[model samples]
Target chain A: MLSGKKRGLQSIEFLQAPIISSSASVAGPLESKSSWAEDFDWIMEDYLLGESSWERTETKVLQQVIQIALDKQQLSFEDIEVFLAGDLLDQIISSNYTARELKTPFLGLYGACSTMAEAILIGAMLVEGGFFTRLVAAAGSHHYTAERQFRFPTEQGVQPAPYSQWTATAAGALVLEAQGNGPRVSSITIGRIVDMNQKDANNLGAAMAPAAADTIHRHFLDLNRDSDYYDLVVTGDLGLVGQDLLEELFVQQGVVPKPNISDCGVLLYDGIPEVNAGGSGCGCSACMLCGPLLKKMYRGDLQRLLFVATGALMSPTSTNQGESIPGIAHAVAIEI
Target chain B: MTPDSNEERKKIEEQEYQQLVEQVRPRPNILLNCIWAFIIGGLICTLGQLILDYFRAQGMSMEDAGAMTAVSMIFLGALLTGLGWYDELGKKAGAGSIIPITGFANAIVASAMEYKREGYIFGVGARIFSIAGPTLLFGFVAAVIIGLVKYLTMLW
Candidate 1:
């Protein structure tokens, strides 16, 4: 039989397993809901850093945010037990280059845009499992860098379709510790990878909506919790189209939550124009996770939240092989 | 003997100067050069558009086609450079010929061709890798290091 103190400690340990103490994002004014554009030309001229590549921009932003966390917490890079990150770059350029500037051990992760939640869940598990006490999970995306690698350079004058997602140029970082009496990560529901065989890249919202709905539905079922329990449920970067489709899909499945469900892609580019649909990139959710959401959490504006970062796992090689893009979503629930 | 030598040297100097002037005279027509540059640049972009259309017709995704366009431009530039056509085009258009995607392709091919004459092991092979080698190296190294840091930071 365990002593009352031991039992209480064990319960606390489980409750505080993976706590997200803080977060931040580096985005342009458009990403912060200050502007909006219906076409890509406006974005090319007004939103982008015409001089620097994505790698440089992403690294600079990520370094700045990490520096803030380090300074605020008075924690040294060497003291961070683990650094987990992901990005859309083939080799995860932002995380890699940024890591070169830091002293912490790194873990390169790639789950497309769903990387933040994935990293958070993994970091939480490590902390809970007593593998490490302090873990930092960060992710970033640069419009130019992602464009050059996955699309075309801005100088090319390529017109983006309406359904196309504007790659959000930003980075997000979260520092997780085992000691805090903060809200603990109550449950994490890993998503099933869903491939809908949709070839139209422009219609990524439609391609990814089913997966988002599927994951959220399954997650709620697994935890035996209603959607109303959480104040907000956020999905990575599904944009306007995916959000609508997700709502409709949920209705069809007989699970209708309040309109409190939001998408990072849609919210990140609220006022920003020229981005016809909205922000979608590896950093879309990464920045959101670190920015407004973290600020709200710290302010006690949110008590329980579910962050589901989604990724469209489509590669040049896979597309070349005539394979349709498969989608993945990972959900991490945090309660304070 | 001194007077004759002086006269002979002056004649030689004047003749050499005139010959140099003749050698420096403009040969290529400026208008023709501009025309070729415009035509070549337009043609390259047209080809790129055609390729993009073809890819899209084949049901390739827009993002995929966008990426393919860049690759296609690089290859087209290399082919033109190898055939000595790009040099002629460059001579005519100046920066106009070099500003587009084809220009990067030409640079890579030209660099490789220039070094290939040196030898296979030390010249061609090594030099071919030199042009984009740094970009590849830096990109890869940066990614690996970031991965390592992320791994280490996650460890307790």
Candidate 2:
């Protein structure tokens, strides 16, 4: 009864089965110091990466990661149908500049931190629907670039509050092809903008928790499957607070998530005194999924996993004007 | 559930969520942070004084030497900020690194460097004063008020 093209209200069951051809993850110096340091293909010597500005450095990372992904697949930009990417900067300058250099047809996206999943979802759909043969999905965020744009300057010498999550300086690029030997993208659940009237920018975890849980619950229901169906269920950079909130919300809704659920923000860093809550930004889940998670799937450790990338959709102007933060989380079921 | 009850439930859930977050949030060691701040702040001030003394010994007036010292300290702070070293210093010293003129310089340079990608005119020029804007605004207003008060006192 539940085996159809459309799932309930939000999810789409991919019958054509788009495959991930290859992926490359690149991280900055601070992210390299994380627990999964060795996972990244290339770790820059510094945040700037010998670039003049943080934004440019982020663009450089995107370019490098895209090239790496393309190289890994033994494909070039001409082979890819289109490149989809986004970042934390205003108008997504990082992805835009990288697009200019890539010379590939590009569609810029903005889902805050959830851009990764959003891109993957759209790319997979395009590939599965026979609209495109090879598509590249990329996203990134720089700590310095995001800090100045969203909160404060990195060098302001301002001590971050406890609830504040450290913005990750990294980028990830994934090449999704119509047919490949890589993991199959089976389903995608698009998230709705969920606002719980929470406005604290420093506490993004709480603001994003409800949206993540809403999407996860919807995904499972739409697919007519239980939590035990997936090998793992992961959320984008919700850190420790959002992880706890997600678990609580699921319990309240009588929806039991898989026991292997983990937050990329919590997994990246090891309870460091510097990063108050944990690692965050568009790059957090992007790098983790492209690197360690993909490797695990390739090694047959994880067969079916739900990758949910969550985002806090808030702007400086909206925040200053006392607007509540709207959060979104898109889920893509990846199977090998 | 009714729509009103759903709203009520959401409010209760929000409150409970806030409480959970607060419960797990880490509390900073205030005493230790204060101690580090005091020591580092005092050392920085001492360094400023030594620079002022050196300038005074080089035959500059005390006022001029004081001004030069402020300028030099601001430059040092901005330099360290550009090099991305001041943040590391801030990690250990806390507010000690920020409660000085150097902190003000760091704020301006950091903003300028951050927004430089947007373009020089709109980015650097506009956001250069983002952090220091309030301080400078109030400082100028206070100066105007003090000048008016001094003039009134003299007339009296």
Most accurate candidate by TM-score: 2
In order, the Cα lDDT scores of the candidates are: 0.71, 0.88
Across B79-152, the per-residue lDDT of candidate 2 in tens digits comes to: 99999988878877888988888888888998888777789999999989887898899999999999999999
Query: DockQ score of candidate 1?
Result: 0.01
For model 2, state the Cα shift of residue A331 in Å. Answer: 0.8
Query: For residues B1-156, could you state the per-residue lDDT of candidate 1 as single tens digits?
Result: 699998787667445533432342224455765676678678878888999998999899999997898898888777877887776566456556776778766656665665554677777567666546765789899999999999999994
Docking class of 2: medium
DockQ of each: 0.01, 0.50
Best-fitting candidate, scored by lDDT = 2
Candidate 2: Cα lDDT at A188: 95
Off by over 4 Å in 2: A1-3, A271-273, B1-9, B48-72, B115-125, B143-156
Per-residue lDDT over A1-336 for candidate 2, one digit per residue giving the tens place of the 0 to 100 score: 754678889999988889888999988787788778777898989888678877778899899999999998788888888999999988998899998988889999999889999999999888887889999999998888888778887676777766789899888989998887899999999999988888889889988999998999999888898877888898998988788888877778888644468988888776565687878999988999998889889889999989999999999999999999999999999999
